[model samples]
Target: MIADRARQAAAAAALVGCLLAAHGTAAADAAAGARLSAARCASCHSSTETIHSTVPLLEGQPKAYFIAQWRAFRERKRTAPVMVNLAGELSEKDVADLAEHYAALAPPPAALASGSDTGRALADRLRCAACHGSALRGTHAGAARLAGQKVQYTTWSLQLMRSGTRSHGTAAKPDPLLADLSNAEIESLAAHLASLR
Candidate 1:
């Protein structure tokens, strides 16, 4: 099972790299992105950490992943009324700038693990590092950072991914890894990920 997942991740990583290259490679202005974030994104997305459990912490997120998410919102491929409205107002440059700025910021502090041994075991069994990196801090492949992420948000995201309502690549396709997960397993994984420093 793990070997199959590793192969899948390798294939996905190559695809993502190709997609990013096709997307574009231009210099972004982080300063401009900082200004835009202060004016437009600071309300819900705090620079320090996630404002709510449901809101994701954007600080120190991978640049490629950030850009992709913003693009998804802008194109309505990922639908959230607020995000779509805000992202729709941004130009491609603005999206790149924001990705640069947020990627350079400090990540949120780690949450207390309490009893996360079980979760850690689960993560190991699932081979989360196949795509999320050994530290689960994301990768150049455009996978979102999972280390120290908000547990509620992670759980919600996993559930959405499982149901094909949200996806890393396409909304129409659900992640096979998450397809058979129960709510308990999802929560355990989220809790474990949230505890990573």
Candidate 2:
């Protein structure tokens, strides 16, 4: 009984320490984040408003996800040239600050594209629902939420998969059905998926 109580006490202390660290991190300077956003990310990406169709609206993304992506970019695991260059200069604290800033911003409206019958049929046949869920909200096992994502990013990711430039893993290979889709078809699907949110 005494050992169990001691372990519980230790766990409570650790949880308190974690909470304090999180609070301290959240209190980091917003001005520094604004400066970093302008200097490092504003050129190709928009931090304040949604103007570009190709670039994703980083605003309102989960801070944890944003931080993870930034770390991936910095490590070259993400393989995006723009992100690689931007993330390379950011320290861990800068990444946390930037994630906080972006997470606090509002998400932009989603643009829905009318899907061609062929594209819709293709999507249905390919069982996109299996991984993306009925609402495309993503699953916990690496499937990303397709809903509310930028259409350009969605299409580009599909194109990458089709061209074998990007593959999730051996267990999650690119669906062969997508390989033959025309650019217009891809765009239509992307727009349809984006409309979910």
For each candidate, the alpha-carbon lDDT, in order, equals 0.82, 0.69
Q: Residue 4 in model 1: shift from native, Å?
A: 56
For residues 36-109, could you state the per-residue lDDT of candidate 2 as single tens digits?
88877756556223455667666555566677677778888778787799788777889877866765665456
Query: On a 0 to 1 TM-score scale, where does candidate 2 land against the true structure?
Result: 0.62
Question: Of the candidates shown, which would achieve the greatest lDDT relative to the real structure?
Answer: 1
**RMSD (Cα, Å) of model 1:** 12.1
Tell me how many clashing residue pairs each candidate has: 0, 0
Residue 24 miss distance in model 2 (angstroms): 8.8
Model 2 worst lDDT window (10 residues): 168-177
CA RMSD of all predictions? 12.1, 5.1
Summed over model 1, clashes come to 0
| Model 2 lDDT, full chain set | 0.69
